[model samples]
Target: MTAPSRPPSDVSAGVGLAGLVGLFAWLAVCRAWPAIAFHLGLATPLEPLSGPTAALAAVLFSGLAMALWSVLVDKVHRRPSTGIDWTRPRPLDEVIDISITKIAGLWATWAVIGFAYCVARWYWQGQYVFAMEVLGAAMLPLFVLSVPYVLWLDRVLVDPRDGAWHFGAMLIGREACDPEQVRIHWRAWAVKGFFCAFMISILPPGWAELTRLDWAEVFASPFAMTHWLTELLFLVDVQIAMVGYLLTCKPLDAQIRSANPHLAGWVAALVCYPPFILMGPGSPLDYHYGTADWSVWLAGWPAPLLWLWGGVLVALTAVYAWATVAFGLRFSNLTWRGTLTNGPYRWTRHPAYLSKNLFWWLSTLPFLVTTHNVNDAVRNTAIMALVSAVYFWRAKTEEAHLLAEDPKYREYHAWMEQAPTLTRALGRLLGAARRRPALQPAE
Candidate 1:
């Protein structure tokens, strides 16, 4: 006979303890790398947050995160149910393994850079080994932590009796979570909740800015109206994207259809966020918004043409808004609900991504900015390109997973892949609409 299954408590404790070890291992190395290098004569001691202070901080931080997460798991596990169905199998280990694997790819990419730096520095007596050492130090910790972090996630998310993830469901005040209906992960909830809180937190200042905007001045300078318009549009879209899913979906428990599983795809998706997205070599994600070169190029044209540019921005923002409307109360990062065939989706596979990226390209405002160092500009350009590429990867990964699981996606994939773009998709839709003929005056 097969060995008996491990007890739930045992499994939970095992994963938690294992993750703690992984966290300790990585944090210890990150804290120790500089001193280790200095002792080995590979580089000088790092002055900023180095040595013992770094060690203490890393230990404290890791300990706190683990301790807090453990407490959260216990609380969540023991919390009373919210009455939704919880009969699905939760392949939590798979989620942990896949997510961690994807994150590791990020570590690998940096590891290469670290090694390249080491190789380059060897010629200069390894003096500037900071790049190599810092990244190199981070790799192992990140990789190791990924395992236990996932395990910890499993402990926190998966319920053996129900075999479903309820962290997200519980937060929405639901006693039970139905994966088939609405799935919420702890990570997504935290992010969505934080942003919603941020928007609410900034409301005072936002209102103050609105109050300060003079409509008279705005009418005299049509451009001035953009201040509030931008704010309004941003506020609406964010509120919907972040909070609507939790509040407005059918079932009253917004179910995230599915999340992406590919390692590279997920990392590419996540680095679009803070901290990691901000991780650049002396180049943070700090930039003011402005019009793109092409938009400025419109200035030499007629006044109508300039007005046309503003309309285009509005249209792009509308496309973004349309997507949220499509998602309604079911939106979450990196998850696929049913394929969208209506509204902007029929127009393009990834309307939001396309529109947002297009908006950014137009708003780069190249004409307004002076020429900068080629290297700096190129690096910035690469970062933007990487962001675009990540979204594209997300679209493909979503298609990959959905097509694998659903015949609906496969059919939709054939249709979307045939078009591969908005123009083509629109053309196809129009042709189909023409063939079907318009409804006669609603009878």
Candidate 2:
């Protein structure tokens, strides 16, 4: 009789097998099918390379159409107030609702349009291709269209009365509101929308390639050069995914949001937001709206993946843990338990916030789909660094607000007098140095 399998052993075996099957399936659907059909369709008369190529062709065309539509919408309909109108009484509630509706409508409308566009494009291409051709024709349009819709949605919606995310005065007189809470910025909405749309547009080719059989060759030659140049961008793709995960997954996100109730919205909004959507085996709406893509981990592991996987997870966790612990220490050691702490607390009462921003930057590492291209590496690194810097500024704003909020915080302000400018200088120097590795000695 065969020996009974231990739980851990069985789990490992199951996971590994699942990963292998997923990886191969993804490669076959994304890369192999497309290439084979493209070549075969080329050889067959009246077969217009119908599937993957046609789908790609549709995405390109539909993307252009969507971009144009955005510009046209900007010119024609032009929803006023930048989506989040702070001037409205109890604006937070109103803005939240409108934002939600806008996001949803934009996503749904564009998804449908995108799908239609791809099918039309494929039909026009008039080619015989593999099953992927039909699938791609059906899917690419939805994916492509989500970009612009997301942008427009952010521009049009603001404040719901009931504190739920909703649209304009359409649902007014339904809920009461307090004047005490702060409203979110409208510009932030536009910026976020643009970011989401841009992210959506950039993802398809690489992803579609990865989903097919000839995936390994995606970065093999001419594509390899492109991959290298945009490796950092590919990495940005990864960062986007990880950010989405951290925001959506309760175990990962709850810790951060536990600090403040308002942060719950931020965390939820960020996680499920449209920007991280990459085409694969899922609903485009799920992709465009907010949700986690478990399919990403379907493959067991990339060779040498342990370092990247473990390092990113560990670093992010450490950052958050340190923040929580530091906050605890600050509270426990303070002379007055309820009184505001001094030192780091004075200059920036929330070192945790600063650290949290840094964690976001670090956590993006494993998520970025790195390709073997110098350019890709540089681009992605630069983008993540830029985003990190932006977050740093955002953290500083939070610090400013915190300083203003607590009177006891004033006493700690004196520490800034003794604070070293060298730290910031050293940080920049170290960052630059680390970005470029030491030259390995010749063998």
Candidate 3:
């Protein structure tokens, strides 16, 4: 048999890898800032950059690095896929009306989101408080800056009357607008409004932990090393993913071309996030009860076994993080920014989900609980299985959305069916079963 064909990726492995290098480089600088200051003989030593501001700076550093790589190396700005024609400059008077409509739509959307934040109790509580504070402070600047940005962008846009413009026209009733475009507009903003806050809230904690972690102590024990390494990888994922959510600019060639329009897709994705997450602590799908972590259960195991288990867990976490990194600045759930076929995506369709579920199983060891009760073990295992099934449902919905939106994704899907992976094996089994003749009713 001939070898399977390799489809082209929208994102190159080098682009995302460059972003990773930049992210870690900034983190290293933050960690060493105080020392650098002291060596320079400053009046006072600089404090460790481990706060929320530092975390935010990490996002900027990583995004700028990726943006530079995308422009300077990949020359992504020139791609026809960017939906821009920088060579043709439309007169300001020609595009002013279109820019105004888009600005109105964008500003109104932000206002609605702000009102929702005020009404939502969760926004004022716990980790969300920081997110709200950050957004609130940026509100004025965003409002002011958006006017010029929108006006400037409308000039070169191949089609200035995008979804946002359609939404504005619908509200004003001064121009004809497609209902479908309005829906698309709301769906895209809904994703950004909900997820951006969640991503920002989560940023500071993992960042603080990594910055403050004692490297010597971490290296002294296998458990400590694996745990912190996993944490560090997660921090990387969060930082890069946050940049993706926030930097959805057309100029960067990282705009959300379309959000998932299917109701099933939205439902599946929403349930996996906060305020709707079913697997949160004390929620319906909580499966952590009566169970011990891998380290806890393996405390009495041999050193070699402990090391091996720790290594496996770290590897799984790394794969999960790598999946996010592969997206570069275009990672977001339930949106078609671009198709990625490189990095870990080359081997599997959903590397993050696959690795994440495996990590949960190995780390939680739900079947091997501290409590001796068989019922607890059975219940935890069943709940864990259900959680995995939810992710499976999510994957299906996401696939459906992408297949409908992008032909490239469909080609990739077809290629995966014939490739020598577990997904291909499963597909072949299913295909064969479908072709098998059914047993005839007693004739």
**Considering every candidate listed, which one attains the maximal TM-score?**
3
Clashing pairs in 3: none
Model 1 scores a C-alpha lDDT of: 0.48
User: How far in Å is the alpha carbon of 52 misplaced in model 3?
Assistant: 0.8
Error of 3 at 239 (Å): 0.4
Order of candidates by lDDT, top first? 3, 1, 2
Candidate 1's C-alpha runs over 4 A off are: 1-212, 248-250, 278-302, 366-369, 372-383, 418-443
Compose the digit string of candidate 2's lDDT tens values, residues 6-67: 11110111211222233334334433454666766755434223234533443333223322
Alpha-carbon RMSD to native, per candidate: 18.2, 19.7, 3.8
Worst 10-residue lDDT window for candidate 1 reads 6-15
Better of 1 and 2 by TM-score: 1
- Provide TM-scores for the models: 0.48, 0.28, 0.94
Model 3, which residues run further than 4 Å from truth? 1-4, 41-46, 425-443
List lDDT for all candidates, in order: 0.48, 0.35, 0.89
lDDT of 2 at 219: 44
Top lDDT hit: 3
